[model samples]
Target: MARTGALLRQAPLTVALAVVALVVGVVTGSLWSPLAGRPLRADLAFGLPSLEQGRWWTPATGAVLALEPVQYLPILVGLLALGGFAEVRLGTGRYATALVASHLVGVLGTAGLLALARGHGYGYADGLARQTDAGMSAGFLGAAAAATATLRPPWRGRVRVLLAAYPLVSLAHVGALFDVEHTLAVLFGLALGPVLLGRRPHLAWRQLTRRDYRLLASGLFVLAAVEGLVTAVAPGGGPLFATLSVQQKHEELANADTLLGASIQAVLWLWLARSLYKGRRVAWRWAVALVGLAMLAQVAGLVYLAVRHLPGWPAGLYELLGNGIGLAALVVGRRAFRNPSRRRARRTAGSLLSPAHEDQRAAATELLQHEGTVNRLAWMTTWPENRWFTDQRSTGYVAYRVHAGVALGLCDPVAAREADREQLLGAFADTAHAAGLVPCLFTVTAETARHALAHGWHALQVAEEAVIDLPRLEFTGKAWQDVRTALNQAAKLGITFRVGPLSEQPRGLQLQVKAISSEWVEDKGLPEMGFTLGGVDEALDPQVRVGLAVDADSTVHGLTSWMPICAPGGGAPVGWTLDVMRRLPGGFRYSMEFLIASACMAFRGEGATTVSLSGAPLARAAPPGGAAETGGSDVAQEPGPDRNALDAFLDRLGQTLEPYYGFRSLQAFKTKFQPRFEPLYLVFPDEAALPRIGLVLSRAYLPDAGVRDLVTLARSGH
Candidate 1:
């Protein structure tokens, strides 16, 4: 009640309008009846006839009342909801201006258009000329549409879609005179919104990612389904239906079987839409086939009409236009729909993973057993989502995923022999090119970068790998004071560290660890990152080891997962790479430090040679003896002729993502361990692909992030 009162106070215009509407409804019996019915309607309602008869007052008078009492419900609700939102966004004065301007324009423009076409013998326009409407919906809809410009995505996109879709769908399905007015009102509002906000009328459209393409295609299918269902059920001579010739209209309304068929088609389209949204290749193929048949049928009908000397164009021209759009989208975005059905996915892994192999994940795991120790990030190639690209001799392979037309290889290619490594890089690139994909390698070690650079590929340092020699690891110096303090503090609090498989932990303890991870993810404005980053699912791998910081009460304070670093020739694990660090918000202030310190000591006890703190993307430690700042200001520039726009972009990107992912902060945190920083590079063949590579990399890391998330990141840059 308090919130409602506050909202009403903020939107006095909306509140006042609602009050006026209610008062008018009560004063005039026309609210329950047909608004003075036939004779007086021309004088009391807003339409061409009323305006032609010099009833200028009808426009203003009709705006406050509904033609029917039940219709008042939706009209009043629309005013309060949409009008209130516009008032809040545009403020009362601007909202009033937008509303009044839009209402008059919609009323006058619609009436003028109907007057011009009234004697043209066009069924839709002539039919509307005799009708009248009385409601505030058109004005409020326009105001809401205009207000949409002030909103940030995905709300901005969402509100605009709703405002646009409502009038268009209503006009097609119902075709009342007010529907035309509503449509005009919304269009005017969209144009007025940015002007009112002091922004340019031009919109800055963001580049769509693969996921976005899938979602858009899915939405188109859903819209088609809705239109079909509405046309079938309502059976009205709407804007869409009125486009049909008399004979075509007779065929449509001839039998119940046609309506049933339309209903079934709608249901089928809806089912396919769900799968398309998930990027199912099967659904894409089905939709393509269906729309292709539709287009072909339309063309055939057009030919028949021409041959028979028909008076009008073929029926369902609007449907043909929609089909053409759906077909174009299905073809243009074909790459986005890569996920096969479940059974096919099980047989082929991903669509491009390993066609002949039953499970590429197992193959990747087997290969990793031989060459995983090539780099700290090598084990990540064995993740379930990766596709394998084998070398000519099948002695080496690159683990990659196709995103935004780029075949992004993760870390170094896995090979049992050193000579096979360089060959694998060229082989992967050649294979990607043969398949018409841009090829790039991310987070590769210096050796792989050198190999690629030797082949004329460009390399840009993207991260710094932190390696701690465990044999020399000690907490004796002042630099180690923080680590020691954390260990001691945790010990004092009865907190103990355990290193093992997370799955082996007590069920309750495992749940707590997951909860801790979830809490960390939820606290961030963006989605949990993937690609090189490991999460709870990866930490649950039996081959990986997990470190837990727990109290005597069995409550877990924090946790970390360490991917195995195996030696060449499938030898025993020589070290561990740090991944998946998460802590409870207020459980222990120094839980992370305690976990890392304990993990290092434990791995050292196990005779492990080294421990990798992993790499912080878009961040690097200061050059040896350079600066004391956590993120060096001079770190943006690298000493090379190749340092150009891409470098500046990376530097800016690192700073932009700092608040969301804390890459620089993590880099600074790793510095406390006195670890050596090794440069990790992103290697690609052409500099022209840098822009695309940048977008793909962002998508790779944040696959689940939507337009709203990207917009938030852009705003954070400011």
Candidate 2:
């Protein structure tokens, strides 16, 4: 009850408006009856002829009155949602302006058109001249449109889609004047959205993103072309098409010419959209030419209609005016589009981490030293596979790669303090949005996911990263038997373990390790994944050290490259993660076991407390769910057949490669150390970005994967 009181106090204006509407409804419903099926609403309702008869104030008064009690219900609800929303976001004065402006745009704009039509000989114009209508719906829709500016990400997009959809739905069911007027009112509201969002100057003509510009061009082209198509094929014609015929006359040649002209315009618009996205010089010329042609056509059409005293000029002149602003804004934003490079579009991180940016790597090293107990995967950012976005203060940095338009962040930004990490992440998101890319974070910890959520990002648990806390670990229980046996067998075979810099190793041994890696790839018949997996090339990094198991004869049996997870500023290596792990085919049965056991003991001696076995991509989730089939008034028995295909395929692949890669088994084997499990998440700016993110991630991980490769892997789990 107290909460309700507080809410009512907060929404005083909205509550007052609803109360006034209810009082009006009661007064009209009881004191008077309908004269001709419409209560005494004619006086307050707006119509062209009525306004001309000195009832010019109907626009403001009409929203307060309703026909009956039943009619008041929906109008009151609309006020509660739209009016309340606007009042809260835009304040009282601006919200009032949105309502008044949208009401007038609908009332006056429709009136002006009707008067022009009545002056001509159009048959439909006579009825509209006196067809009085009253409601708060126009104001409600306008306020709703304005309220969208205050919504958070993804919701704003959803609201825009719904607002655009209303007009399309009304146009499909064009049985009343209210439908068309409502659409116009909403468009007016959308036009005023910028003002509501605090852009006071030229609110109707604001800068638009590439997506918005392309959509506007596409929408205008469709309207012009489709109107002609409809008129040519149908008899009485649509509201837009029929308005062109003042004398109710139809001409085949006129329709044909309209279609042909609009068709060419559509083609030009699409071309312009494409080129505009690519930042092409010709696209700018095309935009000016197309917009100029449209303006000219509308001007010419309006003059011809006036000369003939006809009602119709351009059917959607209001919308054309809105699009004109977008086109102008596009011209203003010409510098945003960069010319495409000759190279094929693919994921690249080298741009920010090249030898020229050696200072960038040094900064990364400095930042890593901030965390004394860093995870083993911490050093992967210094690898060539990732790019860096550092804070202005140089207090933190984020690692990422760009594939398609998606900026896939390696994880949350790495920093000395949580506060600095947040600031860095906020800046990273801003930069990604500015570049028109979808920002996504891969393998993020729970702490990072929470921070992202606070900034309005969505996170989904993707996988679990296995980590061993070296200080607390003990190989003394039943779970440790397998590891203990591997260690014991290493001494028997004279398989001595060694750890040192890969670059400092014997050249002959390095070549042999390379041969073994090549053999493993050829044996599997699948391409090596690059994003999270490393190869011999990555092993050559100066900071990364190698671990190998070899006999007294210096014959390398197995090798593992461990990436240094060091403290921020090129500090001493504090932790290690398995990056490149391979054993020669049929070379040693327990080679991997021996190498891992020795590496842990070696890292323990160096005062490092953790080792990470990196995440396995596409190995976590089983299947993407499908809509289960309902059994007619009962619950669904089972999901559709192909619903679990992906999950099933991954499981099959895991089994097929289990003998060679042993990723899942490796995770299982690490359990003997009883490591702490950390959940990793995939954080994206919004749900709409998931598909593009998924596609880009696939290309990033498996650049050489093809239809044949997929078929081969599925067939034999290779």
Candidate 3:
């Protein structure tokens, strides 16, 4: 019931029109000669035929031409009902155009099909050979098809029901109850309707399959079947009108016995219309009047045809005027019924775009600027380094630089170290990991490494430090051969080697630093160590020495800074630490080795006995004794063989990673100096605290956490 009501509401006008058509059809038969065919001669042109013989048109032509105009009256009513309702829903002009176009196309298609059929070897060719006519049944079916296309959701099923009914009607005709051509014309109209009408509004499939729709469709199907069967079985001829000359016995049966059936159809159509109108809140008076007017026009047209037997002009003109008037009324009603609130909405939208809103631009701009700043700051720790901060002209107060692609504080390293260097480093590492940037620390001092362990920094062995007896060892023999070979290559390439202070370096020399203590230990994946570079100033301190390797063009190729090692009992100044080293472009041959040799010589000149080339900054090793604490004969305990094994493995890794990271290559290159390997121990605040460091490191480096940071930390000498 709800579904039927909804459908009726959606297409009230169509329902009303269908009812009017039925009423007109039944009334026409009652008022005019029951046996007579179509009222208008033009209808013959549309496949209808006159009863008169020798009319220039052939017998088949006359038969095919003949349309049971009564049958189409209901269809036209359906079209009008659907059209008006659709117009109400989709605007008057669109609805009107869709209906008219569909009808026109449907009619033309039917005519073309008839022509084609006649041209082909169908039996109709012999009968309709001389006839070339057209009719509006095709147009009516087309309108119905159009309605089907435009109807939405709950109403769609109703449209589908009507569409299905069209073919069934055609089948009834083919079953010998009615003319097959007429049925074909109606179906052709219906099939073309959707094409002309275009698409209906979109709705969910479930909405279209309601209970009332099923009930109504079932009832209609049963009714149509009963009508078909009655017409099929009923005999022809009636005593009330012996003078009548019916074309078929079925026509006589329809005229004599189907009055009650026709009346019932008319009543159902009216009920559908009334239900639709009521649901839509359309004024009952207007609906009633409109229906009455349509009925009157249909009656007037029928009466004129019955009395005058007028030519084509009267019937055509009457139909044209009547349809035009009906369309006008529909248009007026639609305009009057439009929602005022929708108009107000358009006005409001227009107001927003007006010049009065121009002042809001400033506020919008401020909001955008704030958002951009917040987003930038939020993502600041994400990269290895802040590329944006490198630009001196950058406006924001926040600035950063990548120390080997790891983001670190520029001015707050001390604060970070105090608060928790490990946490800060972890944040930086996490940010870098997320951004796919490599997180690394270069030239980090022992103190910083300790701080990293305290906060949680993992280490892996990359290379051994090559401490040389500066005063005793000479750069000669097999060692000299290697140095000479490197020098000769450098000489041919016009490369030079030079040493310089931090202030006297060429523009090609690049400098970077890692704080010994800062809130950056979390990324290192090792417990923190208490170490601080807060008191050390590399540029001004006399205890520190900076070494440079440059090419012939005076371009710095590599550099290493050295500082005195702190020891007890009046420090002996036994070795100079390689605080920093870098390879400059176009540097001297054996630049790295040369830099170490030169630094060793300078330290010897300074009365130093030995040089601490420095442990590989990145190195790690597994615990000794085959993953267990007990020392066994099976495990070679040659001063922690497990540590040596891990170092050896990292040495291989350094060889592999050398080409990619220059620092890794430097670590490997330093091996030729034959410095003693040392084990670097990470002293965490507590052993149980390692997992926290590991978690932060995992989030920061994921799969590479253990391999890069932990391995490097574990292999480094304490």
Candidate 4:
């Protein structure tokens, strides 16, 4: 049963069709001989002959003019075997199409060749010659060609060459010259077979080698030698020197030699096919069926031929046996070369989890906490709903998503020893890797920077931290020049400055609130800055501090606010802080500076040693290297009226506010500061896990609607 299944699987179509053709041919051959002997008394032809003459109707043609059944039975069998193998490999549709087209081309070409020969007055037209033949040789060749076309890159060229060579060898039969009719038909069939149906049926070289090529080669070689010797020792002459003068005999010998070469070619093809299909597995049924059917068809053809006195029966049978052996070899070879690792990898890739799955969040969280620190930047302190965490404070790491993969990240570190930093970074990377993630680190620390370079982390963008040093923080030099000029311009307009708490007195309250309200409207735009006294009362808590600036006329000029830097115990505020500041027309520069200075003095009186003047309100300029710094300094010396105006404004604002706010105009206004820029390091568990984190964060806090504006405001210090 298994063997039967295998044979069916291997050559289902070929086996079935071959059996039908053989049965039809035998029956036809049995009945047609008697009719052929009687000859035609009148001019009446039908079937194949009618078709050849372009006539649609002719009943006699069917029985009398179909292929000389007995003579072409072996050819039909060979074709069926070849076509079946080709069909199994190439797929039924493609194989059938190629075979049908090739056969049509071959039949038409043979007809054309016959016409041409007759036109040239070349050979006698016997009764047998008038009949059209039926065989699958052309179709099989077409399938073979199609199969060759399907080979992969490495074997394509060799397969092409083999296909091309088949025709050349077939044409080498000189006996074709004497038997022009049959010769023309065969030659035409060979020529047109591949032309009309160019694609070779798809066959794995491995299977071909195992099932057919190797054994076919051996069989063909033996048959060729036997045929050559028989021709050499024919009855016309001496045992070994027979028929030396006959051109037909010489052609036969040449054909035998060509067949010998074809056998070698078959052997090579088998080897290559075997090599290519070495690691491929085949279904057991398919393997058995294909081999069995081919062998069966060939055997059946041989038996029928032997009964009919047809030549080449033994050779054909041997060829069939060879095909079976080749198939067996392929089956064994495939089993021997399979690779388990590659199969596993394919399975793994196929099963990768989708990003949107909830499991991904769990995976990301587990990956981050595997290490002590989750290194990533805090673009938004609050995380969004769709992300792994609802806030940045959550225990998971944030990762930067890039084209290659996720890059693990951490917010700039507040403080850490060099060793600690290294440990954290390494742990971050290890965690990410454990979770099958990629790692990326963003940093502004020299130590972290060096470590990143050493470890092959890519440097994307370098941003400097522009800061004001509260201890030595004073706006002076070129920085204050712009402020001083603005102050002087305001003084000319009769603008004056004062400083006090929000609830100081009626005048102070009115001026401070007005200034705050006006500045808020101007900066944030009226629609965005909607508020009234009631709204302010609702929003501001007792913990908030307010400062006001007023003109000599008691009109509000500017105002600002701060929240105290609370102690660790959360008792009284430890430091007076300047959080948000704004200014209006009258004494704008002076009042703004005064408010800051007053807040600082208040904080200092309360025993605070240092002030945290916040970062620059804009994206800081790129840092200048050695020679570039010198060039910048040179440019600063050639200041014009604009510089003078800036200087005047800073002078007035700085002097009045310096004592209270500790504000040095030169230090505050200058682009260059002497204070050290502290490093902030963003750490991540690893590089690969960054994408999911980034996607989650980006979606929630920085939704498509508010992302641009938020970024702008943050950069502008609003």
CA-RMSD of model 1: 11.9
Candidate 2 vs candidate 4, lDDT winner:
2
Using Cα atoms with residue i matched to residue i, what is each candidate's TM-score against the true structure?
Answer: 0.56, 0.63, 0.27, 0.30
lDDT per residue (tens digit) for residues 467-537 in model 1: 88889777887777889999999989999999899999999999998888888888887899999998999
lDDT of 2 by residue, 235-350 (tens): 33335544555454445345534556656655665656655554445555666676777677767766776888875544536435745765675566655543332142222343
Sorted on TM-score, best first, the list reads 2, 1, 4, 3
lDDT of 4 by residue, 293-356 (tens): 7688878867876797655443465457566665665455443323223234235321111233
CA deviation > 4 Å runs, candidate 3: 1-464, 487-500, 504-543, 551-553, 570-572, 620-664, 695-718
Which candidate wins on lDDT?
A: 1
Q: Rank the candidates by lDDT, best first.
A: 1, 2, 4, 3
How many clashes in each structure?
0, 13, 80, 78
The CA lDDT of each predicted structure is 0.81, 0.66, 0.40, 0.42
| Cα deviation of 638, candidate 3, in Å | 14
Off by over 4 Å in 1: 1-12, 27-44, 84-93, 151-162, 199-220, 243-250, 256-258, 274-289, 295-315, 328-340, 349-718
User: TM-score winner among the candidates?
Assistant: 2
Alpha carbon lDDT of residue 452, candidate 4?
A: 60
